[model samples]
Target: MTLDPNTLLAILAMAAATVLTRVSGLVLIHFVTIGANQKRALEAIPPAVLMAVIAPTALVTGPAETLAALATALAAMRLPLLAAVATGVLVVAVGRAVIRV
Candidate 1:
């Protein structure tokens, strides 16, 4: 498969935009003074972003996904991050296979 000139340009443009946003974040961060609240907000941002992406899908899909998310959250509190993720994935896969939902 080959990309034509327009498609190639579009891909490059998107990549440049993505890089700009990331680099700008780093640059802008240097100007900001992070106090306790700001630090907490920064830490919360990732999980909030993750939940924003996942919650809609899970809610719309069914109970299996919801349960899997709950399991992931609980496991994440204690297990290593990767293990927690694996546990969530495994639970969802098994639940889907057995429950047929």
Candidate 2:
């Protein structure tokens, strides 16, 4: 199957945009000096973004997802991030199997 010219152009445009975004962030960081508070806020961004993405799905989805998100939060209190995420995945799988939802 031949790739349509528009599809190829769109793909190339997206790739360029992604690279430009990442490179711009790096360049900005290189020129900027961050203080302690700013650094702390920056460090918090990943978890905030993760929760922002997960919270809506957990709330909007069925019981299994909600239960799994709860489990993940509880696990996160004691475990590392990776383990907490794994706990969520495991809980969600089991919840879905048992609840059939």
Candidate 3:
């Protein structure tokens, strides 16, 4: 299949924007003096963003996603972030397979 030129240009533009945003964040961080509380708040942003994205899906979607999200939350209480996320993915996969969602 042939790639559309407009699609390719859009993809490239998106990639460039993502890179620029990240680079700017890194550069700005080096110049800025962040206090302990600020740093902690900044660190919380990723997980907050992740939950903001997933929570809607879990709530609106069927039982499988909700179960998986619950499992992930429980796992996150005990496990590291990455491990907890993995547990969530595994739960979702198995839930879908078992429940046939």
Candidate 4:
């Protein structure tokens, strides 16, 4: 099969977008001043962003997933990372199983 020029350009565009996205955060951080609240917010942002992204899906899918997410958050606060992850997965699995009954 012959490679088309438009396809090549599209691939390059996607690669550039990906590269810029990954580096933009690091680049922007150099300009920011960190204080105690800023430090805490930065630490919290990843999980907050993740849940924000997932929240609509959970809401659309219904209560079981949302409750499981709540359980996971509670478990995460008191447990080790790995254990918290396991707890989340287990809660989701068990909630799903029970919901189907």
Each candidate's clash count: 0, 0, 0, 0
Supply the TM-score for candidate 4: 0.71
Q: Estimate each model's TM-score.
A: 0.70, 0.75, 0.65, 0.71
CA lDDT of every candidate: 0.89, 0.95, 0.94, 0.85
Q: Which ranges of candidate 4 are over 4 A from the true structure?
A: 24-32
Give a tens-digit lDDT track for model 1, residues 1-101: 87799999999999999999999999998998889998998899999999899889987887778878989988999999999999999988887877864
Candidate 2 clashing pairs, residues 3+ apart or interchain: none
- What local lDDT score does residue 6 receive in model 3, on the 0 to 100 scale? 100
lDDT of 1 at 11: 92
TM-score of 1: 0.70
Task: Return whichever of 1 and 2 wins on lDDT.
Answer: 2
Per-residue accuracy of model 2 over 54-87 as CA lDDT, tens digit each: 8998999999999999999999989998999999
What alpha-carbon RMSD in Å does predicted model 1 have with respect to the real structure?
A: 2.9
Runs in model 2 deviating more than 4 A are 89-101
TM-score of 2: 0.75
Poorest lDDT segment (10 consecutive residues) of candidate 4:
58-67
Better-scoring candidate (TM-score), 2 or 3: 2
> lDDT of candidate 2 vs native?
0.95
Q: Model 3 over residues 1-101: C-alpha lDDT tens digits?
A: 99999999999999999999999999898889999999999999998998899899898998989999999999998999899999999999998999974
